[model samples]
Structures are given as C-alpha cells and as structure tokens.
Target: MKRTTLALLGLVSLAACAQAPQGAAADAAGSQAATAQAPAPAPKAAPRPDTPEGRALAALRELDPNIEPDRLRAAPIPGFREAIVSGQTLYVSDDGRYVFIPGVNGALFDIRQQKNLSEASLASLRRELLQEIPKSERIVFAPPDPKYTVTVFTDVECGYCRKLHQEIAEYNRQGIAIEYLAFPRMGLGSEDYRKMVAVWCAPDRRRALTDAKNDRPVPVRECKTTVNQQYALGQRVGLTGTPMILAPDGTQLGGYVPPRQLRERLDKLAQGGAGAGAP
Candidate 1:
C-alpha cells in the first residue's frame, strides 16, 4: 500500500510536468484526460475526495473497509491507486484527490429495470450537466409533461443515430425530455470528426448539426472546447453507439427507444423509484 501511494504521487507529478500539446491534432488525444484541478486536502487521518490519490484510496476503502489499506500501491492512473487486494481492478484516489464518480454498466446485469448502485449515485450529478436539446437542432416533439429525461450522445454519421433521429417526435410525445451531447464516433483525426467540429463551431450549431446529419458540408473552422470532452464523458461511461440514452435515475439505456416504448420505460422507472434493487 505504501508503494502504491508513492507511485500514484509519481503519476501526478508527471502529469504536472508534461506540457500541453499545441494544435488541433494534439488536442483531441488529450481531451479524454482533461479535468478540473484536484481539490484541497483534508486534515491528517481523515481522507477526502479532493486529491486524486485520496479519492482512489477512499473508493477502495469504501468497497472493503476491513481490507488493509497499507497493502495498496499506486499503479498507472494519476492520483489513483491500484492495489493488488484480491486482484480486482480496484481503482481509488492515490491521495484522496478526486471522487471516483461511478458510471453504470446496467446492460451487464440481469435485472434490466434496476441500475447499478454506484451508477445510480452519479445520476443526479450527470443530470445537472445534461444539455437541453435545442429546438432547431432537433425536430421538436415534446410530450405534455416529461416524467423522464435523457441525455443522448449522438453522432451524425451513425446509421443507428439516424434511425433514432427519425423518431424524435415519437419520443417527445411520450413525455421524455431528450437532450443531446455530441459524440463523434470517429477518432479526432478523421474527416468525419472535422465536420463535427465545424457543426459544433458553426454560428448556427443547430442548423449545422442538422446539415451534417443530412450529409451536407459546413465551412471548416477551429475552436478549443469540450466537444470531444463530451465524447470522452460518454466513453468513460462505456457509451459505444450513437444514441446512448441516460434515464433520470442514472439508468443507462443504449440503442434506440421509440417514443411510446420509451415513455413506458420512463413510467416504470419513475414508479419503481431510485435505488430500487440497484446494483
């Protein structure tokens, strides 16, 4: 554990040492790792989520309070630790840096209705960050009142995305508020991705996005922002497709959900309530 702690510090120091790369080509590669600065430390013997190392350790400790924290050693992730306790991919803060905000792997479980515990915990936070779908970027179709909300990670080039897009009205009619976050499937270097950036950077982001989805061209321009950060956020939560929908309870819904069926799903979720048999 002592060694792990030291190693985690090393990673953090390295990150501080590494210079940010210049140019659009390099920015995409680094976007996945960009985050807010680590927070202030807690008093001695009291772990807090302000430090990367601290967050990693705290998460591990929370998982197994009885385990010997002394045995953990830092591995690869900066401000995070990888202890060999039982050989799991046990990640935690190297020094209690950042909270190991959990994401759900709901599709992996048998209880389709129930979200994972760790993931459910992160739902409220995710909701706060979810962007409202622009009326222009989307074909406006809203239900009388939305009982369920979802933030969709969308890509213009994806066929499934197009299929989901076609049902925009149907979903809105079901009282499901569908917000969108851009997630270009192709890597940053591809021509498709270049188009996506243009779509995001356009004076009329909504129209440009629509044009891109329709395979029309937009004038190329560059801006340094979180377009890819949004994509990385999706990836961090294991989003693999164009339309990765997140339900209000932090329940993850992948693939397409027609409006009527989606309403039913939301109804079930709302009725069941939070943490109902969550993993």
Candidate 2:
C-alpha cells in the first residue's frame, strides 16, 4: 500500500510539472531565440565623397590605407595638402584629384623668406617623430652636462660615420651630445645590419659601437636589438646615407661636420631662438 501511494504521488508530481505554466526556463529559451534572430551591428559607413575631408581621405587611402588622414595638413602651397607617408613627403591636391611626391631634394621654395617651405615643415615633422624614440634605444656619447644634443643616423661600415665617431670625444668636449642610431645602408638582414645588431646587443653598447666604428671587431652576440627600428626611422627621416646628423630641432646639419663647426651651428641656432635642445 505504501508503494502504491508513493507511485501515485510520483504520478501527481509528473502531472503538476507537465501542467506547470511557462516560467524561467520557457522565458530563457524564448530570450535566447530572440537573441539568435537579432541582426548583427552594421559596419561603419565610409566617408562620403561629397565632403572635402571625405574626398581627401579617399584619395589618400587610395595611395595607402595606412596613411593617417590626421597626419595631413595644409601645405605651404596653395590648394594642396601635405603628408609624410612611409618617410616620403607627399603633396595632394585639396580636391583629391592629384597626388605629388617630391623628388630627391625637392622643396617648395619661398622666395620672399629665402627658405624651403617644405623642408621647414619636414623639420618640424622629423622633430616630432624623433622625439618618439627613447634615449635607451640609442648608443649615446655625452658630457656630464650637455648644452646641445644631436641624433645621427649611422651605418656600421660607412666611412663618414666612422669619421664622425673618431671625433665623438671632441663633440662631447664642445658640450654637444651625440646619440647614434643604426641605419644599415646595406639594408636589414645584411652583414652590416648584423654587425649593428651585435653592437646594440652588447653589454657595453657605447664601447661596442666605438670599436665597430674604429673597424675593430665587435663580438658576435645574438640578442634582440633596435637596429631594424632605427634603420626604418632613418629612412622615414629622408636619410640617404650614413652619418646623417640632425640638430635638436631636426634640422639636418649635413654629414660629418667638424666638431667645432657643429657646435658653432648649434650655438647659432640657439641664439636665433630656433631651439637646439633635444626635444
């Protein structure tokens, strides 16, 4: 009789469950179904070509999608927009109908000021870009208190680079700090590039760099280094060869200036209020 009662109770419980109103489980299933049926969020729409900014962006992206529109600004030339893409200065028509890449040593000369407007713009850009690199990444030779600092793009095997290094002490003596960044003229993954990597990876990077510049052997030590990055940066800043010396304001002081002359130039810039201090 107890078993029969227990079986009856179980049957009643089953009936109650089967007749139970749709609650949390049913609601959850329904919610899941609704969610599954929902449409995905739409992708951002492209800029409309009808607008000036849109047209400019479209033209710039057509050249390279990586070209940041924000980097572009009004060019010194009327009806043009200027930008630096992959280290090359570019001028695009405001209407997005044309793009102009200056050839080697190309500039927009302003006769009234007797200056290269493009170069001035480029100098400012280079200054901003160089500031992004930290001192830790560079092989530096500096006095205890430096009055001026210059960054040099150098190749391990370049003659002018070695010449400049030979006079590094003199530069420091003249209150100028020298920071060296690798720019392997032979390109990345080459023998020269490997040597620069070894120098950067050395326990004493400054000594290793000095030895390399002196044509002494730098010990082959395998380690990660900023050689490649520095090389890329060199290319971006219009470096055609090694020992490309730049003032604190990113003004190209040309290659391998005598220490005294470099100091004089720096002093002149400072006196002229062009800011020859490291940015």
Candidate 3:
C-alpha cells in the first residue's frame, strides 16, 4: 500500500565479461564478490543538541508535548523541519524560532503534475488514522462486491447530507460502499448530537440512519456510542460541512457528487488518474 534486494550488477558484469589471467582474475573476483555481499554500513545518527535538527526537535517537544521527536526530519524547505503528530504535519524552523501549520495557503501544488502534494500527504494521513475506526461504529451500505469505498461525514440536519443519503442505494449499486460517520454540526449536547447518538445506538443502525436522514424519529434509546468521537475526528481532519466524502485513499472529495459521476471518478482514481470533480 505504500524495496527489493539489490543485486551486485558491477561485480556480476565484471565476472561475466572480464578475461584477465586466471589466478589473479579469480582472486580479484572473489574479493569483489565478498565486498559486494557485505552488508552496507548503518546510517550515521543525527547529531545531538546544538544542531539545527536537535533544536527543532526540542522546540517541537515544547510546543506539542505528545510529539515524538524521533520522527522530526529536515524538510525540503531549507530552514524548516517536518514532523507528524496525531496524523497532522507540523513544520518548525531549524533555529526553533518559527513554526508553521499547513493551511489552505500552505497547500503546495505541483502544477506540472496537476497534483496537490500537501493534500495528498494529508489524505494518506487521514486514511491511516481512520483505519483505526471499528466497522461496528459506522453505518455502512456496501454492495455485494464493492469496487471502491467512501467514508462520509454526515449530519442528520444537513440538507446535502440528506440528499446524499437518499441516493445511498444508487451509490451502492455503483459498487461504491458508503460508510457513514456521524458529524453533528450542532455541538455536543445539542438536539442534533442527541439524535445522532440515538441513530448510532439503534439495533439496526443502517435503517436508523436512513430514517433519521429522512426526518423520521428514531427510538431515542442511547447507550454507548462513537458519535462524539466521530465528530471530533471530523474536526481533526478539517471537515467544515456535512456529506464530506473521503475516498478509499483518504482524499477528501469535499462535497456531494452525483452517483454516476462519483463512480466514474472513483474508476479514474483506481486507474491511476488524478482525482476528478471538485472538492
């Protein structure tokens, strides 16, 4: 989802093609073979304190107590070092005097390749983090043979979210599995949050979600639920609206796409083409 053994080509070529005197050539070949087979030296460790990377790691630790400094490394940007903490990337200056958080303006695009490097990295991170979510916590509508899957952050009261839900069958038919994660736009303790909890706690969660999205009452019997956790995850991933679709690779598709168009886009992505349709 994300290297092969290296053959000693030079040694092999020399052995195959060289025609030197017998004993000397054999001795030389043996020496060369031994050298080639020897394990490569281990990489040198980063220098200790007083070094730029060291200072950056120290500063990052102060800023985020949970950061694992071992993960920090010099970034392509000359003065900045990058680290991933809780699936989000952070950049700190070599001198430990400046810190940068990725944002809309910070999203670097490779115009030649027509790709958003920042978004791609973030998407991969999101996928890694989201993989921890148990299937039991989601309301999933999957086809018999789903070719692609999408995780949608949805709110019961959001009109577009409801529209997406209404077409859930169509999405499934298109071989696109839909996994719903509750995102109560209204904060915790609000009616929307409570309703989402009710839906999540329902014995038949898929049906409950469908009914709730249709504005029908779901039995308000709350038990243990991950609705709040899902909302928090949505926030962590920078979700600002309901019906936000996350493709299988964690690419955020932003908003709703018509079923056929969504399927076509998924196909293109599967074929190694860039993501189609706006976010």
TM-score of every prediction relative to native? 0.50, 0.61, 0.62
After superposition, candidate 1 runs with Cα above 4 Å error = 1-145, 273-279
Poorest stretch of ten by lDDT in candidate 1: 106-115
Give the lowest summed-lDDT range of ten residues in model 3: 1-10
Clashing residue pairs in candidate 2 are: none
lDDT accuracy of residue 14 in candidate 1? 41
For residues 107-215, what per-residue lDDT tens digits would candidate 1 score against the true structure?
1111223223345555655655543334344322346786666767788889878777777777776667767677878877788778878877788876777778778
Off by over 4 Å in 2: 1-103, 273-279
Model 3 C-alpha lDDT per residue in residues 191-268, reported as the tens digit of each score? 999999999988999888888988899999879887778888998877877878988888776588888989987877
lDDT of 2 by residue, 193-258 (tens): 889899999999998988888889999988877777788888888887778989887888778888
Candidate 2, position 73, lDDT: 64
Error of 3 at 60 (Å): 35
Quote the lDDT for 254 in model 3.
Answer: 58
Q: Is candidate 1 or candidate 3 better by lDDT?
A: 3
